[model samples]
Target chain A: MSVLVVLEQRGGKWNRTSFEALAAGQKIGQALATPVTAAVLGSNIDSLATEAAAFDIQKVFAIDDAALEQYTPDGYAAALEQLIQASTPKVVVFPHTYQVRDYAPKLATRFRKSLVSDVVDLKTVSGGLSYVRQLFQGKLNADIPAEGDLQFVSIQAGAFRAAEPASATNPIEQFRVKLDPSAIRSKPEAPYREAQRSVDLGAAPVIVSVGRGIKEKENLPVVEALANALGAELAASRPICDNGWLPMERQVGSSGQTVSPKVYFAVGISGAIQHLVGMKGSKTVVAINKDENAPIFETADYGIVGDLFEVVPALVEEIQKTKA
Target chain B: MKIIVSVKQVPARDSSLRVDAQGKWLEEADLTYEMNEPDAYALEEALQLKEKLGGEVVVLCAGPQRAAQTIREALAKGADRAIHIEWEERAAPDALTTAQLLANAVKPESPDFILTGLQSDDLGYGQTGVVLAELLGFAHATIVMEVEPQGDAVRVKRELEDGWFQHVSLPLPVVLTIQSGIKKLRYATLMGIKKAKTKEVKTIPASQLGIDLNSGLVMERIYLPTRSKKTQIFSGEPKQAAHQLVEKLKFEARVI
Candidate 1:
């Protein structure tokens, strides 16, 4: 009869995407005429629960446990399983994040349910709901109908706006989970950053990014020449960085840096939803690829359906001439 | 150490897709298939571990009869043997059902560890590995970037968002979903291909697994994504299109 949105936080700082999940939950709750509740699991997360309570939800559950401080699949899943058993929410929503991807499926499986993951949109038909998620690396969209008594769904980033905080103050409850120390496997060490990020692509005015279309590591210079000519930072999709052709810090996608430069030149990159979500904020996106139906073209403002090898060099020369 | 690598066969990355007449799946005709890219990395990781530790590497795949091609590619790349769970359904089963079938197959091997791609290229569920681990009562980690075996446990480096990584330690009988590009994939050699043809491939029908195929979630329809923006395409010679793009960037968009 109610919707439960799980909010994720690390070291007591909210992962902004949690609000987007709240927004999605609120919309679903209104549509179904049900109450909406939220829960944040961590040690010393009372403030987080209070912050969430101000967001127009009916109640906030602060599930605190000393073992839940650092994220472990066993600890979080076990804790959430207990919470769901106690509350019995009809629908569960989460933000499709790396942390969620790690453990949400395991939690859902415990209840004989499968999570409809990375959902981009939702529709109500005949008083029932269907979730839309991308397939074939975002080449196609599949509509999955919502069935079963308990439904677990995760919303994609940027699919919903963050819920606005209101003056209404709701009740906050402290739910204690009995977690056994021995049951928690996978001891986690401190998280660390590799190779201090030297170039912040976020501040750049223009960025020229490459993808699998470049073909070989030897051909990278073709795109580098254009980046140099335009005075733009050179970035690349996950495959380029995974190949070690480009440094990991220069990668753009869900796991890498998210940039919003004024102009994003996607040279030979067929847009996967992972890469598209990172650079979709660019003011002007220009894509150069041989395939006209590449998903990059769907988000691009201007596109050239031709070989990047031939188009990039000519564009570099034109930009240099205009600068002169 | 005995490692079982779970792989999948998906349509080639460059294939043009058409919806099937039922609108429930892709058209099978005129489609080329290849080993799922992420699973290729998983196989490579397993092969490397086998080489270092001098144990067996087994590839486990679940698909239609065509999946045997992908299994051969894995064996050629250096797996000791393979297990194929023949599933001929047109529409893929949900993640939970797929994991249950895999768990039933993997239970007999009792491998020291299991490795699979973080997600498949086709369904992109990204949950089968973890769910498989749970069904088998094993500890698990996803997005694993590195793995080093200890006496009885393994230490793995897992990728977090925004370029952060955390090192985790788990005991044997664990499941680790490998991130793509963790290691370079080895191509199938003529000699290895010959050996692969002779290697053991045990085929088990899905019905023999005795797991229910009915999935809770149902695919209502499939279609191309709607365009969010109006893209003005310049189609012609490469030089002419480049010139037109520069003109638009300079004047119309004013980004330059």
Candidate 2:
């Protein structure tokens, strides 16, 4: 029995979810007594392969197809399905990303297999495995198990710890998988990059996110200054985006980018499940909300029940003094 | 153009829930039920469309008998007719199965357009509409915020990331998942509510749909999160204090 994890990458680098999926697959692999194999599909994935090598991965199946240079659900599903059948993995893992979301179900349906997606927890069941998923926007939890072979699941980003690279020296060998490019039906159009995605907040270790509590659009300078002072990225809640206070990429939620920054300081943000699903996996959640009963406090590791306007400047001053 | 809207009754958004001793699902008691918020929004959109374009609005639901209350409430709010699938055997089945039951009922009406809330409030899988689109082989767009109907096709605006919106036109026999709160729900009129008691609410069972995909997804266990005091406070000179907090946040907390 072996575990196969499909790592999501773009332009050779791993996406934010790759780290989470890798760690989760390793966790399951260790319990199953099988080595986790990583699958990379693209024209090239040097950086991703190097990152995968640091993990407890036994082998990296790197398939380079021009058809895969850009992601199309049909191409991705076909390639992953091929590698999956060839590897004969007991379980197939993927990051719950937009790219994966579009095609994971299609692939699952093709094989007549069930796909348990956005998994929050996992355990080895009596004869197999069981997983926990959020129902109704995190208001409820539903634990389900795989009843058939070739089990498939997509891990929500930040849901699991990005386990430190394996202790022992693990050799990383790349395996080439044969592909029939002609079989790809939909040739991707010229990649149209979103003009505003120049700054990817996912890589920022420290993010200072402002919520609706920030009050007015003019008050954004406070959070921006705070972010600048701490050398952190600025993020926002869905409301802020809905009102045009910030760019869409800056919004954190289930539909937006799921972030796992080292320090996520939330200001004026009421913790809605839609927003919590995006940032709950952060290493440390610090919430500054005047409302003590705010749900954000539940997941917040450190919370100050006070006005963000009063708290932000005071905290920024302390940081400047330390810099001096 | 007649429009048919399918809605579901679900636990209120604010209802507190917990797993019972059995662990198969959340405690149903002590929970208040309502018309699924998004579905209410869809029904409102349909009523408005019917008002503007001169047609009839039909509300369809698939559930047990208690759901009649929700259907009647819709009728009171102005739906011309109501269909409730009375399934005593299955409390809740997956979307594809439910779609078969809904499609079996709604197909006869031969409405020009069909709309449903993005997903059930209880199971926020956000898949039912898309799956329904595939099952019915109708063009579909999820996350639809605004909709306008043409003679042969329908135009819809989809919500995208970063405050972006796209408009697309899909030919008839299309399904569009309605995003909640595009407009506020209209209250049932006192006169309409009185007349609603006389409207017909039909009931059917799942066994009648006749299509089967083994229900592999089953609710096995559920539990609430353990309560813990997780809070931190930072003090001192603004800049330096921010630096210290940033250090703790990055190395120790890692939320940045």
Candidate 1 local lDDT, A1-324, one digit each (tens):
799999999998998888999999998888778999999999988888889889999999999899998999999999999999999998999999999999999999999899999888888988877889989888899999877779999998888998989967899989989999899988999999897889888888999999999999999999999999988999999999999999988988888889999899999899987898789889999999887778899989999988899999989888888889
Candidate 2 C-alpha lDDT tens digits along B76-100: 9999888787777536666556666
Candidate 1 docking band: high
Which residue runs of candidate 2 sit more than 4 Å off their true CA positions?
A1-4, A9-14, A33-90, A111-114, A125-128, A162-273, A277-295, A303-324, B1-3, B45-57, B103-113, B146-172, B181-200, B211-214, B227-256
Q: What is the lDDT of residue A36 in candidate 1?
A: 98
Q: What is the C-alpha lDDT profile of model 2 across A194-261, one tens digit per residue?
A: 45675577788889999878889999998998899878989998667756768767878765677888
* Leading candidate by DockQ: 1
lDDT of 1 by residue, B194-221 (tens): 9999999999999899977766678899
TM-score of structure candidate 2: 0.68
Model 1 pairs in collision = none
Best lDDT among the predictions, by candidate number? 1
Interface RMSD of 1: 1.2
* Native contact fraction, candidates in order: 0.88, 0.31
**Which of the numbered candidates is closest to the native, going by highest TM-score?**
1
* Residue B36 Cα positional deviation in candidate 2, in Å, after optimal superposition: 2.4
